[model samples]
Target: MQTSTETETFGFIVNDISRLIRAEMDRRTTEAGLGLTTGEGRVLLNVRRFGPTRQNLLAERLGVEAMTLSGLVDRLESKGYVERQPDPADRRAKLVTLTDEGEAVVCGMEPITAAIRADAARGIDPDDWQLLLAVLKVARNNLMAARAEAQSAESAAA
Candidate 1:
């Protein structure tokens, strides 16, 4: 019932790929016995990648609600995988950092993610892979800019 053109649109393809990748990550992480839900794994990896980020900023980056992130952080903290510390520059804001155990879990995740990347890139040439990454980066930046512009306009109109 679906036409090739409809399925080939940028939004359709990108969304489909994103869903598939998330599902694969969930399955792989479970099989690896990381004892994390996909959302928790994502939080850990993002924290490892960004390092000691403020909770609000981390929520924005992760495209999650602050309350949702708070719940996840609570669980991770209870598991001895992460800790929340008051931000030095903002007394009221909290920063999230991975505990040693979280770092260990992230280290364990690296190979699994690398394998997924390898599998996804299997048929692509090195140059094409680099090009694909570059293109996606540009697309992401453009979308972020658009969102910022809309937010600015909304604030100005208020």
Candidate 2:
């Protein structure tokens, strides 16, 4: 029932909507005391939510390179927000965890985070929202696996 032109228009609308939501999140998050960059806020969140996580695994989850991850960790560690401990099974590896200060920082931003997510979803019917979520999840899985495969191929080629 859908035409190609209509589908294209819908894609453009979705892209613009996604951009607007991201910009709003950036604006409100900056207004919070998170400071500097969105990456910092994201790092704080990850360390708070997924800390005691291995550095490599954290880097993979963030979809960032090791150097980038290290830099984020450095800033957080300096702020007394995070710390690295030796992995029990791997002496060469370290686990990252959030300090009490880090938790406080993330907790303080909770209201803003919830507000942003809710605003982005405003006016969407429950069924439509769930359908969009399901489709997006499938698309995300395909893209992620494809990206990993492409990276592996490039590495092999190099």
Number of clashes in every candidate structure? 0, 0
Off by over 4 Å in 1: 1-5
Q: 25-142, model 1: which lDDT tens digit per residue?
A: 8999999998888789889999999999999999998889999999999999999999999999999999999999999999999998998899889999999999999999999999
Q: Candidate 2's C-alpha lDDT?
A: 0.82
Worst 10 residues of 1 by lDDT: 1-10
Query: How many angstroms is residue 58 displaced in model 1 relative to the true structure, after the best TM-score fit?
Result: 1.3
> How close is every model to the real structure, measured as TM-score?
0.93, 0.74
lDDT of 1 at 143: 95
Candidate 2's C-alpha runs over 4 A off are 1-22, 145-158
The positional error of residue 103 in candidate 1, measured at the CA in angstroms, is: 0.6
- lDDT string for model 2 (32-94, tens) is 756636666777777777658898998888778999999999998999988999999998999
